[model samples]
Target: MGRGRQKAKATKQARDIKYYSPNTDYSALQRELKGPEGRATSHFANDPVEPDYSAYVDKYADDLQEDDGEVDTRRIG
Candidate 1:
């Protein structure tokens, strides 16, 4: 057998790319209701709680509100 340059075989070609329409309806989602100062007032206004950090917040209120002024501080530890 003699060594020869093998021609590359052409594979299946892909058709036109399909794309989804951009989400333009911002009001479609249940947005967070803002208070008079434009801040979230209700607890449910924020993202849904998975493990529920409220209990942890209550458990460590003293540590959480330790002059830092930040509401969420469970990650400090």
Candidate 2:
């Protein structure tokens, strides 16, 4: 309600946060980080699939080759 009360509440919250230390499950953390199979290979198991852009090159060959005279060679302010 008052400025002093609000300030005191904020200070108390800040102090609590500063000194806060909850129990950490290191085994669970290891499991999550290492991720199954007793190894970390689960993340690297699959290779990322790349999309083919070669089709677009053939379709827009003429458009890609044609350059408009509106090419700006000067530095833009």
Candidate 3:
């Protein structure tokens, strides 16, 4: 097909898909959203997410670190 015909066909197909609506089962959706009755709402209570990093932060604060602040870069050899 020519470029114009191919483009028109693609445009029509895209418009059909954009306006398409399929039958929705809302009750099934509600059940899926509710989930199982016995399942925990969150797994955080049983697991240690992040370990104590404050100690490491304080300990490493003494180490010599590079300057993160802005510096004048205008000087050129």
Q: Would you list the C-alpha lDDT of every candidate in the order shown? A: 0.51, 0.83, 0.82
TM-score of 1: 0.25
Which pairs clash (backbone N, Cα, C closer than 3 Å) in model 1?
A: none
Which candidate number would show the highest lDDT if scored against the true structure?
Answer: 2
Rank all candidate structures by their TM-score, best first, as comma-separated numbers.
3, 2, 1
lDDT of 1 by residue, 1-77 (tens): 33332322211122222344566756644352333455546556466657757768778888757767656647764
TM-scores for candidates 1 onward, in order:
0.25, 0.47, 0.48
Candidate 2 ranges with C-alpha deviation above 4 Å:
38-77
In candidate 3, which residue ranges exceed 4 Å CA deviation? 40-77
lDDT string for model 3 (1-77, tens) is 47999899999999999999999999999999888889867555776677877868877875526556667689799
How much lDDT does candidate 3 score? 0.82
> On residues 1-77, what C-alpha lDDT tens digit does candidate 2 reach at each position?
47999999999999999999999999999988765685645545477878999979888998767877678699989
